[model samples]
Target chain A: MILETKNLSIGYSAKNKSKILQSSLNLKLKSGNLVSLVGPNGVGKSTLLKTLCKLIRPIEGEICIKGESLESAESNALAMVLTQGIYAHGFTVFDVVSLGRYPYTNWIGKMTAHDVQIIENAMASVHIGHLAHQSAMQLSDGEKQRMMIAKALAQETPLIILDEPTSHLDLVNKIEIIHLLHQLSRQHSKAILMVTHELDLAIQNSDEMWIMSQEGIQMGCPEDLILDGRLQRLFQSNQIVFNQDQLHFQRNHLLSKPIWMKSNSDGLAEKLSFQLLQKLGYYLEAGYKDCQLELLSNQTWQITKNNSVFQFENLAGVQDFLRNN
Target chain B: MTIRILLLSILFVVLSLLSLLTGSVWISPSEIYEALTNPQLNVVNHFIFTQLRLSKTIAAIVVGMGLPISGLMMQTLYRNPLAGPFVLGISSGASLGVALFVFAGSSLLALSPWLLSLGLGFFAILGAFLVMLLVLTVSISIRNSASLLVVGIMVGSLSTALVSVMQYYSSPQLLQRFVVWTFGSLGGIHWNEIIVMTLVVSFSIVFSFGLMKSMNALMINEDYAKGLGIKVNYLKIKMIVLSSLMAGIITAYAGPIAFIGVAIPHLARNFIHTSDHRKTLPIVLLLGSNMMLICDLISQLPGGTTVLPINSVTALFGAPIVIWIVIKNRSFLNS
Candidate 1:
């Protein structure tokens, strides 16, 4: 366990009484564990990360990293730490990443060739090497996010904390970032604690998911979350329904799919076929991509794809159409 | 190119030479050289060359270099394109200090020129220090750069008004002396004061040079500076101290020689078109020194005859160039 938040009441006040989230948060985030702190908006996820980084003074909490308390650490003498996507000043990608060594830097802030090599390596790790000379503000959204990751990597922190790491990314960008975090966790032996609202993706990609709910913080595997029927409740609203068995959201306006055409393709084909079905008003399977065309609900799509041939859901319907034609 | 720096240095040297040779007492170049080397010709020509010209010439250089570097610091600190040592009430503080002592503090202008002028320098520095301290306090307290700049200008106006009141109370003899100081003469600045000004300006220049990278970053925003782990407060405090000290001392010696401090940095920024402090600092120093020397030389060209105040000439020549820069870079200013 690189990090342990002991009774961490995190907020920004010198006095012990003005804590925003007062709870005994005890968790050991170790290497090879990708943890997502998923909660609704404005639930002190950012505050917790800020507190952990000592950017915000926690009112009544002691964040013990490795073995020492955060307050005991000297000016910027924290055991390796990085805050993701934080902008404190304008610097070149090279300049910003070089600051990860702020604690190690001398009075003159000299960067040796060895330091330059480390900076280069970090930039390459996050794939921002080409942007070395570019000003930070000029970067695209995805590039900026990657640069932040590079900065964190440059810090080489054992425990990395990110607040809303994927806040402004599209789906592809979100997945790529998650994939990068996963790689860093595994390869670098970094304990990654990311705060995000991305439920399905975070739960899927992370080795463990940390849930911040009305019930309190809980940590469990994705499977346990599904089986325990706890993951579905986080985003359940009056207009939407959650399928505990399937571990996904179902909107109220799904339509049924035709059967005979859903019997031909394999797994990848099933997804593409399901997408094609969705475009063509055909329904997809709830949990398994199994080709089962059944009357589940009126105006709701009980979709079917590829059949007994490949055992695909949406693909089976397309197969059925080929045979009929 | 580094060669351009060489060229500029050479040019500064040549100008310094021309300034030495072209004065009213036109001894031959050979005679000047002989006076520099030989003991027979040394005392008479050396007195004319060293005491009368070299000190004033060097004082002009110091004044030139000091104002712009101080201006550069002011510009970066306030994040204001127009902010400079003079515009920020520092010169007014110095002017007020000089006015108070020379005019109101005494009645004998002819008898005691040097001794009473001691208080002039001290009061000037104090005024400049007060203005800077007020600006620094307001900037930190308000947490807004623009408001701080406005407050500095307001303070300048207030100080100027107070100096006027001092002038109103002064005797005729004291008023003539005070009025002469207000005209901003580089003449009669003691060799020692120029040496002290040079040392103080060098300290400021070095102080600014040390914060080059981070100050470059500061041109963006404070938050961005923090991300790079730059302790912004320490940097700001250090910079304000250096700039105020430079402005205060220069004001003490040169009687609020205006526009060079305000204009030189803008010209440097224009020359580079980059926020790089490394490139800008040297240019500000060189160009500022050059501009000040030229302004002082032109004002003392025997045609102005009455020895026009360096402050007024600097305004006449410097105002348009700086205004042009501000208008051209208006977009940058609004940010």
Candidate 2:
């Protein structure tokens, strides 16, 4: 096990008093594992991560790293990636990554040949070797995220913790980062943990999932959590609900405005129109007389409502026409 | 980079020579050589060389090196581009010390030149240290850097207010003395005070180099630095003490030279396109020294008997460079 916490209580302490957020928690993280911590807002996910990183003191209990108490472990043995983006003005991608070697470098931080090799390998691992000399500010958000991950990799620690690593990324980049993290865990045998709001991606990519709420935390494999109904209770709201069939969350509202959907051919276009109508809060039906949508194979949508037929070149046009009618 | 360092060194040497040659009394190179090697041949030039021009040159070098380095440290410590050495009220503290000495302590001490200089430097350093101690105590309780900045500004204002009230009630002769000191001169420091300033500035700057890596980490992000096991608070306090010592001692001997502290670090960053202190530290030191020498030479007005205040000359010379660099390289703001 790379990390383990026993009966841990975390919170803030003032002059003579303390405010405890959560207590009596036992957690374990092992090598070659990718764990995603998903929780509602204000559930102390960040506070817990801070406590693990030793940024703040835990109100009670013990956190051990590699079988050693946290306070006794060598500080160089642990590494963390934070949510805050760096200014990185006038710094190249290489310079920023080289900062991860701060623990091993001398006082002046002069890089040895070994350190140089490690930095190069880190950049190559993230596929940013081409951008080694480019200013960090010029990279796209996704590229910057990769650079930060590479920085943590260069730290050469057995364990790595991240806070919302993919918070600012687009959909494709978000999945790509999670996939890369998963690969890093298995390939390098490093224990990787992250706090994220990407539930679907986390379920798909992480080896284990930690679902946290105000009541407490539940840790298990993604399938086990879903089977035991733990994932269903992760959020407390009637407007949103966990969909068992799709393995994701969806709005539980009574989908209004029943509209019949049809197409000449059962292909990508027809399936897309069907999904779109269902997503826009319309109860999708087949062969209904009152309202009808005919998605043609010629990239046009025909909507028949109240005995008036409206044709459009796209799904957006169909939505606009239906809303007006 | 090596070439730039070499060029800066050459320029510094040339400027030092020019500054030595450019005073109210026109002393040529040969005459200077004679004054140094064969002192008996030209007694007047020898006295002027060792007593006036040399001390002034060394004083300019000390202030130039000290202020910008402290300013760079301040900017890094606070993670603020606009921070300078005196932002924490060190200058104001030095001023209050001088004011109290002129307004009150003058009657208590003998009017000998040696005693006056020693007393002024001692009291100014004491005042600066006292302010630093108060700031250090307050900083222990305040975790936020912005709040520390606010506290520093408030302390500066409070000290300035006290000095103004003291000025309003002072005798005319005493007021004139205090006002002249505030105008600031690189020429007023004698050999005795110059040695102390040089030693303290050198020590502080050399010590700063040892922490350059930690400073870089802190500048990137404070919490991240903490997670890396850096003692952030200790680093901040060390920076504060070093900056105060350099600013305090220079203000005492040379009367609060300005512009160099705030502007030199920016100039280095603009020219080098990097804020890595390992790279910029040497550049800032060289540029700062050159600027001081240039400003002092301008103030002296070689052929004329009248001299301008060093404070005005630094602003007049430095402000335009800053404006030009900022306008030309607008990305400096990002750095």
Candidate 3:
């Protein structure tokens, strides 16, 4: 095991009082695995990550890394990437990556040839070696996020923890970052834990999911948690719910009756029409009902309701007709 | 980078020579050489060179190097580009000390001039140390750098307000003396006071080099620095103490010299395009030294007798450079 928390309690403490965020959590992380910490906003996910990284003190219990108590373990043994914004004013990408060698360097932070090789390898692994000499401030948000991950990788610790590493990234960048993290965990044998709100991506990519809810934390394989219906406890809102079949969250929209939709093939338009109907609180099915939709050629939509046929040249017209009628 | 350093060092040497030569009575290089070789033979030239010009030049160099280093440390500590050596009101605290000394120690003015200045230095350091303690105490509970900067501004304002109240009731003579002190002077420092400033400023600058690695990590952010195993709070306190010591000591001797502290670091960063303290430290030191010498030489008005106050000269010379850098590299401050 790379990290194990026994009866760990995390929270904030003032001079005279302490506010407990979460308590009585037993969590274990092994090398060569990617764990996603999923929770609602304000669920103390960041506080838990902070406590685990020792940025803040744990309110109770022991956190051990590699069989040594966290309180006593040297900081070089662990590495973390925080969600805090960092602006690399004048530092190059290579200079920024070289900062990860802090724990290993001497008092003056002079890097040796071995350390340089590690930084090079880290940037190459993240596919950012081409931008080594580029100013960090000029990089795109996705590139900067990768550079931050490469920093953690260069730390050479057995475990790495990231807080929302994929936030503020575009769809392609998000997928690429998650995929890179998965590869790093498996190929490098580094136990990786990340806190993220991308539930669908987490479900598809993570080896284990640590679900933080109001009750407590539930840790298990994503499939196991889904099988036991533990993911439903994440939110109390009736408008949003976990969809077991799709392995993602869905809106609990009210439906009057099922609407049958027909298409020669499910192309972008059909998928979009189906999504629009579902979003408008209409249940979609294969069989016919009082309301029916057929995609004609030339990107037109035909809707028949109550034996009345209506045609829309665009999906917007279909949306307007459905929303009003 | 090496070439830049070499160029800056060469500029520093040239500026040092110019500062030494440009005085009321122009002493030729031959006379300067003669005065150095045989002090007893050329008493007047030797006196002007070693006793007057040399001490003042050393004063300018040390203060120049000290203030920028202090400012660089504070900027990194508070993560603010506008932060300076006196941002925590060390200069104001020194002013308060000097004000109190002038009003309360009027009787001591009858004694030797050396003793009076010594007493003033004592009180100034004491006041700065008191404020340092208060800031550190407040910092223990305040977690963020922005809050600490707010606290520092408050402390500075409090000290300035107190100094104002004292200034309001003082006699004209005492007021003039205090006001003149506020205008700041590099030439007023004699050998003994220059020795103290050199020791304090050089020691602080040297000691700061030891903090370069931790400071580099801190440039990323506090949490990141802590994750690197840096004792963040301890490092902050050390930076605070070191900067306060340099700013306080220089203020006590030179009377709140301005602009160099806040401007030189920016100049160095713009010139080199890096914030790594290990590299910037030397560049800032040399750049600061060069800047102060240039300011001092300009204040003397080269070839004229009357001298402008160092404070006004720094503001006049430095404000434009800072404005240009800010406009040219708009994002360098935050970067």
| Best of the candidates, DockQ | 3
Clashes of each: 33, 0, 1
| Residue pairs with backbone overlap in model 2 | none
Local accuracy of candidate 3 as per-residue lDDT tens digits, B15-42 = 9998888887888899999999999999
Give model 2 RMSD, 1 decimal.
3.2
Best by lDDT: 3
**Interface DockQ of candidate 3:** 0.68
- lDDT tens readout by residue for model 3, A1-325: 9899999999999999999989998999999999999998887899999998998899999999999999889977788888887856778999888888998999899889999999999999999999999998889999999998998999999999999998999999999999999999989999999999988889899999999987899899998888888887666688988876567888887776688888864577777887788788888777776889989864788999999999989989999999898
> What's the TM-score of each model vs. the native?
0.77, 0.91, 0.92
Q: Over the stretch B69-167, how does candidate 1's per-residue lDDT look in tens digits?
A: 888888888777777877777788777776766665454444454554455566777777777778767766774445666787788899889878877
- TM-score-best of 2 and 3: 3
lDDT of 2: 0.84
Where does model 2 exceed 4 Å of error? Answer: A256-264, A280-314, A317-321, B86-89, B111-119, B126-157, B321-335
Query: What is the overall TM-score of model 3 with all chains considered together?
Result: 0.92
lDDT tens per residue, model 2, B1-335: 89999999999999999888878888999999988999998899999989999999998898999999988987786555655756677677877887777788557556776677777777777777777677667866874555776887788889889999999998887788788888899986788789878988999999999888888888887877776778888998788778878888888889977668878998888778888888989999999999999999989886799889999998886677656744655564434
lDDT of 2 by residue, A1-325 (tens): 9899999999899999998888887999999999999998888899999999999999999999989999977767677888887866667889888888988888999999999999999999889999999998789999998998898899899999999989889998998999999999998999999999998899999999988887778999988998888887887678888877678887775678788987786577876786777777788767787898887665888888889888899888877776667
Q: What is the TM-score of chain A alone in each candidate?
A: 0.74, 0.92, 0.92
